[model samples]
Target chain A: MHSDLVASVRRFNRTVTQRVGALDDEYMARGRPLAQARLLWEIGPDGAEVAAVRARLGLDSGYLSRLLRNLENDGLVTVGPDDQLGGDGRVRVAALTESGRAEWTELDKRSDELAWSILEPLTAQRRQRLTSAMAEVERLLVASMVVIEPCSPNDPRARACLRAYARDVARRFDDGFDPALSTPVRDEQLIPPAGVFLLATLNSEPVGCGAVKLHPGTPAEIKRVWVADTVRGLGVGRRMLGELEEYAAERGWTAIRLDTNRNLTEAIAMYRSAGYREIERYNTEHYAHHWFEKRLRPPRTSGSRGHSDN
Target chain B: MHSDLVASVRRFNRTVTQRVGALDDEYMARGRPLAQARLLWEIGPDGAEVAAVRARLGLDSGYLSRLLRNLENDGLVTVGPDDQLGGDGRVRVAALTESGRAEWTELDKRSDELAWSILEPLTAQRRQRLTSAMAEVERLLVASMVVIEPCSPNDPRARACLRAYARDVARRFDDGFDPALSTPVRDEQLIPPAGVFLLATLNSEPVGCGAVKLHPGTPAEIKRVWVADTVRGLGVGRRMLGELEEYAAERGWTAIRLDTNRNLTEAIAMYRSAGYREIERYNTEHYAHHWFEKRLRPPRTSGSRGHSDN
Candidate 1:
């Protein structure tokens, strides 16, 4: 919260808001305002559940319905019960009409052109720098929004996060991973006293998960550390590691360990940098190439001091 | 632009606009609209001529008057002819009252707080990354807005840019730079047939300048290659170099050379990367530590093919 930091951020806000014409009544040369344009975009190519759109945008249900009604009146979109359209029939969904699709395409094209305009004045080299910096900023911003919360292992979103993580590792591992083959933690085991599951969510949608198993006489074992690729490099992996360590320490465990395949270089690096020392294989995990262990102090009661660099 | 590049920029635009609340009906809890707030900011501490304010914001005179009138009615500002207030009555000027200054300070503080809110959610590491990325984005965006145009070296803005450049180099260089001591290019020398001056402007404000001296038999010598710190990393230096080379080539000068002080590490690096080859010292100037020359190909005539990146 330094003044210099605040100044830089404010300057960034001023420049970008002006550059993107966000303050203009019209957006991207489109006749409609930005909110409508954004809604049309959220409807997207495949459409979306109306409730999901409302949730994603954090809009009130009444406000969202009014906006949808405006789009409908303009003949650009339609809202109907999902079940009536071969969906669940209960949840409402929004979809663009033919004209809406065309309008959205035009908007999309112009949005690209606007982006091009921002890039066009620079040489090829600077363009690359700007784009890469943008990618970095986007990643960090998304990471900032991800909230890590303890969730029941059996909770639907938490389960979904775990299933996605397993699917990703299965695709990436040399010998495809199978939950059946790996050491299994039942829902009961992931509950308090045995273990706890942590879910990382971005705007309320779970994007990553990690879990830790407590042992009475042995070191706690951290497991299932995974982050969505979209949020990688935002330090989510390290944050989750720190959180799980605190979770273990809260249960009076002083040592922790985790195993990973050699192919997962980034995760290995994260673990190494987070104060975990490489240890000789202590388990019979078939695909494990590296094992790491870290000694933890009793949990710090002062919340402000626990966030050591990872 | 590549679709990926465009998509990245658009995504950046979306996230920043949302985070900055640029689309909100109110800004920073300010009661007035953004335009009025912006005008208040532009009026600044010392106040500004009404015409200058209008020109700076690119606002129509009528619209500017309306906004000023609104501020006046709110008892936040006062407008009066220059002669009536102080000296010349021809131009009208606007200045904030005591209440206006207090309100402006409050708005400024709230602006900083809003910026802080964006950073507060992030951990220390991510905050650093976000701030650094924001600085890069700001640099590039400013660079993208700069338009380089051939201007008379004697033009007021052109000379202003050159003066600013000289002042900067004077502060940066060891012995300090003096236009009187450096190889002098008379105003006549910088005019066409002998040389050409290129002015780099962002929103009509001169931010940088460069000049090339063409000789009948020897390679053209580029001088005063400078970009304001505000627009430095956007590659304005490189673009200016390329443009100067093209300007020289158009007049049939096939090679170009420039000299720089050792303290100017970034300029030297840019020269090296832009295909300038180091040579034995070619200038008698006291501060020149490195001299670079580059053989230029005939300028590409096709406009469509030249902008390969964006």
Candidate 2:
């Protein structure tokens, strides 16, 4: 890694942390500290189930319970069994009280004010540029956190991601997509020795998938690459493609190919830019209008087993 | 002021802080905390005066001394009087010992690894996009923190910024620029009630300046508009322009004009994009080529005052 890039990222972290008051024990002068304020905001107006809150914030269950007790003592919230949202009768949910509602409004107002304080001094054009750049940075940062790992094709999460991918293509394609009518590479084929499946996840939620099939004497094939719309611009698709290529190269394969529908313009552009060349159709799949191929180099090996996995 | 834009920035702050481990007491696995590690990095290879570290980090004198003492006790550094760097005989400077150099190298290496960990999972193209976006975000964030304040034309920092501007123009102009030869808006002219001079500063260091000379019956003229090259692409020029216009509007003038040499192509483009129109030459100044003007809007009113000045 280039040292300058590290310095730039560190500088960005320092500047942004200071600007956002992350270093402050008390945030936005709300009387309570940032973690508590954040808890209040997360609980929100309608409130949330104890499990949901714990999972969303990735907090220790005991720590989250303590925070809830603090808020309850403050008369800012009430925690009890909730059946209205259709959870089990014994499951407890936390909700804002009337006073808590007012407090939440105040917290939100102060949060907005804090945000605006960073932008108000800037000219209109600078504010626009800064916000858009921030959006881009946020997208990429989220992308960086997404984990792409080899998984069983039949893993529940992997299958769910494929289902989401299928649903998306069905809605987008003119004739409507049907896996039953398309080329089949079932569980047996996606398992190791035949091929491998890769799952992309964010915060433990599966969001994307891709598969590669090895050919003993012929070029390997790539298929089923997809990314959740929530992470579309984050470059997840390209990352999965690279991972699939690495999977193939590790198995001693030097080439891979894939087919796609013409309506999938962005995917086509991504493949072209990723060094895939347009080639003659090698299959009669009813959906595929364009076929592409790319040759791969040997996978890189490090002298030391550095961190190459999440 | 846009609510969505504010929300975007806040979300970005949350994501980036978490990703960079700013919330962690232990940073990049360094044994010492972030403050001490940062002090080591700031003290750097050549060593630095204690005062420079305090000023650069904005740490209180007592707090800085305490941190230095901690490092001193760890046998990683030595802080003592140094006269070779030209400070007073009793002035203290901090330098790394042999073990401190080894420790600094360890910290540097880990920092690089942490940065690479963010990029290593990304494909090459995605890493490129991320780093470049970070660069853009860093520039805009710095630009956002810059404060523009009304200052006496003869204020030492303001004069220093002006001298730097003159030196820059002299190097760039075909015939070379001379403050003596150009039309001068003397100190008296820039004093309030006649006009105002604004200084642009980042962390208390003046980086740019502009002055407006109010005209009783004619459009006010913007003069000496300049930004340090270090901050050029961060939209500081446009900000300074907007600020000068605001200064004029507060005094009841609504139109502003300025002239520049053709060699300053970027300045010309910025003027055009900022709604300045190319009118006939407004002066016979030695380096003047194109003259531009713009009409200003009424100053925005908010019940709450904003931090537009340092």
User: Whose TM-score is greatest here?
Assistant: 2
Model 1 lDDT tens row, A84-108? 5456867898999999999989877
Interface RMS deviation of candidate 2: 2.7
Model 1 residue B105 lDDT score:
90
Model 1 interface Cα RMSD in Å: 2.0
What digit string (tens of lDDT, one per residue) describes model 2 on residues A171-255?
8889999888898877888888999999999978898999998868978999889899898877789889988998898778999
What is residue B79's positional error in candidate 1, in angstroms?
A: 5.9
Chain B TM-score, candidates in order: 0.81, 0.85
The lDDT, on a scale of 0 to 1, for candidate 2 is 0.82
- The residue pairs found clashing in candidate 2 are none
**Candidate 1 on B35-67: residue-level lDDT in tens?**
888898889867889989998888999999999
